[model samples]
Target: MEVRELLAQTHKLPNVPDIVRELIQQLNNPNADYGDIADKVIKDQTLSLKILRLVNSAHFGLSRKVSSINEAVVMLGMTQLKTMVIASGIAGSVKEVDGLDLKKFWSDSFRVAALAKWYAEKSTGVDPDTAFTVGLIHNIGRLLLHITKPKLAEAIQTLVDQSDCSRSDAEMERLNFTTPEAGQALLALWQFPENLGDTVRYHRQPLSAEAPSPLCATLHIACYINAAIGKQQPLEEVIAMFPSAEAELAGLPANIAAVSEEAMQIESGLDGLI
Candidate 1:
């Protein structure tokens, strides 16, 4: 089925919480009343608890425990607080997917998020928090597919396993669309920022965009590094094989060895997030 068809089966897809929708809107609003937003988030005890647990966990490395949403905003800054709230809301919305390894999926996503944040910090004029948030949700389409079309999703996975083709190729062959495309569609349906949808849409082919986006390029690099590190490739090998073209598109420095190490270190400390 196409992306529109996939999305039409609304019952099969996880719903974005109202608070998360509001937070997404706030992303582009510099005058957003964060205090009011924090209050609204706090009212959702479950989500707020998850945010607090994560912030106080070893992931954030905050010196003191954050006892409330307001405290978390003050300690982590508005951008980080919004990121946590959005992540917590989205993750909490999906209870399970029958054929998916939820733990591994979230772990890898978080790693990419951390790495994207690192790269965005190094790139000129990129919002590190936006990069992190996008990285975390970049693969959400895979989860949606597993939930809505388990058999087809399994078929695609089997095809990838039995062939030399990449997952995106397998997805296109079977579903006529890639996970990034589905993810972009979902983000649009959720009324997230257009730029976020654009980034997710072109992350797999950043250079293909009319105007290459630094955030998209950053995510591409982050995903590449995450896969390399997952394979236990040495730091030297990863550096040598870095996506230099993408880096140039992102306006990052040529020597990314130190950046990679720092990002991986940060990801290593975020086990609690997954």
Candidate 2:
């Protein structure tokens, strides 16, 4: 089925919370204040608990426990609090999918998010927080597919494994559209910024556009590095195989050894969240 058809069945897609939608709007609004954002988050008991849990978790390594949303905002800053809220909202939206390991899926996503943030920090004009948020949500299309068409999604995975092909290729062959396309569609439907949708759409082919997006290139390299790390490849070997073209596209320095080391260190922190 086409992505539109998949999304047309609104009941099949996970329901994004109103609070998440509001917070997503805040992501693009510079005028959004910490007090206002914290007030909004505090209203949602479930989401508030999750955010607090993450803040107090080993992820932040706070010296003292944060017991309130106001305190969390003060401790994490508006950017970080917003990222965590949006992430918690999105993850909480979907409870489960048949034949999918939700824990591992989120864990891998966090790795990509952390890596994307690392790359963004090394690049100019790209917001590291935005990069991290986009990375966390980039593969959401796969979850949408699993939710709407479990059998087809499973078939695509099977094809990917048997042929040792990329998931995007397998998705195109099976569904006539790629996961990035689906993810872009979902983000658009969610009323996220147009640039975010574009980044997700072109991440698989970061240079295909007339003016290549550094954010997209950053995500591309992050995914590449995460995949390499997943294979038990040594950090030195992974860095050795790093695509210089992508690094150039992202406007990051040639020597990223320090960035890679710092990014990889956050894996343990992310593990507690999952």
Candidate 3:
């Protein structure tokens, strides 16, 4: 099936609650009113409670309860919000597919997102929030593949079972393209921001990205790091792929350092989130 067909099948894919999606979009808009944005967030009772809890969570470095969405936003900022959104989306959408290994998939995804946030902070002026969102959404093509063609998903697994190749390599060799491209295409169609779509498209090959992006180099390196430790790739080789990846990872600045620390504090704070 095609991309549109895949999305159509996602009626079973889980809704993110219109208010949640709206809050993210408004957060992105320069002229968006904060009061209206908070109002939208408060529309979803569960999400609002979750946001408040997250604000009070150690991840935000806050000592008091965040009574409102606006204060939560101020305390946690957009990066953590994206994490909550994605984590919640995942919890709401997951299915029990026979023979599919979802745990390994998300462990690697979250780990890479963590590393990518660090790299983005080190590499550019890109908000660590944007970096985290890009990293979390980068693998969406896999999600699409399962939704579009279940047989292809099983087939891809078989290929991986028999080969040592990366998923991007497997997809490109077999399909004449990669998941990142297809994913970026779909998110663009869904009206996600251009830079976000670009990040998903070029995450694996930052050097040859289609659009100019500050997040590309970092995402590439972050993914490499996860592939290095989380999967089969050797650490030395993955670090070697990018000139100073090892050094950058070793030298993460204060805020990024704090983020990493928070990641360790809760193995499952925003459980059920993307």
Candidate 4:
């Protein structure tokens, strides 16, 4: 099926909570009342519980436990709270698939988010939170496919495992579209900012983007870093595979020897996120 057709199927697919959409709109309002945002989240007990659980988890490193949605908002700030809400929403959407290791999927995604945020922070003008948000959700298309097209998703995974090919190539061969494209379509359908949608869309081929984005290039670097670290690749190999080209485009340093260590650190950050 085409990207649009896949997107159309999302009406029946589960991902973000309805409260997240409201939270996004509220966050965009200049006159947004913090109380209203807190109240909105509290109304969704499932999401509220998830947020509290995440904040209290060691990953957040709070001195005191967060007991309520309002407390979480106050402690995390609106922007940070929004990020967690989306994170929790995505977590709730993940359903058990026959062959998918859901824990590993989210662990890797969190690794990318933490690494992307690290690179974005080092870059001149990129928002670290924006980078984190995109990194966390960039592979959402895979989740989407697992929900709607389990057999096809299974086949694509098998192709990647057996053929020593990239996931993008396997997806294109099986489904005629890459996860990035599906991710872009899903982001647009969710009414996320156009920039975020574009960032997800061209992350696999940042140079091919209509306008080269620091965020996109950062994502590319982050993905490479995550993969390299997870696979325990050598330092020289990591540099050759990641950072060199993508970091230049992102205005980051070419040396990526230390980034593997940074990526390793995010495994802890993934603690409550999954």
1-274 in candidate 3: lDDT tens per residue?
3445555665544344554455445545667565564566677677677667666766556777779776766777754654676555543456544455676666666666676666656654656666666676678777667666678777777887799987777776666667787788767756777777887887766656545455766676566656555455543454345435333433444344223323332233443333
- The superposed Cα distance between candidate 4 and the true structure at residue 4, in angstroms, equals 3.0
Per-candidate TM-scores read 0.92, 0.92, 0.72, 0.86
Which lDDT tens digits does candidate 4 get at residues 1-274?
6877666775556667776666544533567665666677888887777778878887779999889877887788877777777667776676675567888888788778878888888887677777887898888888778767889999998898899898889998998999788888887888877788899889988999879988899998888877777788877666555556667888776565455565555552544756
Off by over 4 Å in 3: 1-14, 23-28, 52-83, 90-99, 173-176, 232-238, 241-269, 272-274
> Candidate 4, residue 264: CA error in Å?
3.5
Ten-residue stretch with the least lDDT total in model 4 = 262-271
Error of 4 at 238 (Å): 1.5
Clashes found in each candidate (C-alpha, N, C closer than 3 A): 0, 0, 8, 0
**Model 2 residue 174 distance off true place after TM-score fit, in angstroms:** 1.0
Any residue pairs clashing in model 2, and if so which?
Answer: none
Per-candidate local distance difference test: 0.83, 0.81, 0.61, 0.77
Model 1, runs deviating above 4 Å:
59-65, 268-274
Those runs of model 2 whose alpha carbons end farther than 4 Å from true positions after fitting are 257-259, 268-274
Question: Which has the greatest lDDT?
Answer: 1
Record all residue pairs in model 4 with backbone atoms less than 3 Å apart, i.e. clashing: none
User: Per-residue lDDT of 1-274 in model 2, one digit per residue for the tens?
Assistant: 6889888979878888887777666665677675776787889888888878878987588999999998987787877787787777777788888988988888888888888988888897688878887888889888888888889999998998899788888998899999889989999998887777888888878888666888889999888888877887787877777777878988888776546655556562444444
- Residue 91 miss distance in model 2 (angstroms): 0.8
- Ranking of models by lDDT: 1, 2, 4, 3
Query: Which has the higher lDDT value, candidate number 1 or candidate number 2?
Result: 1
Worst 10-residue lDDT window, candidate 2: 265-274
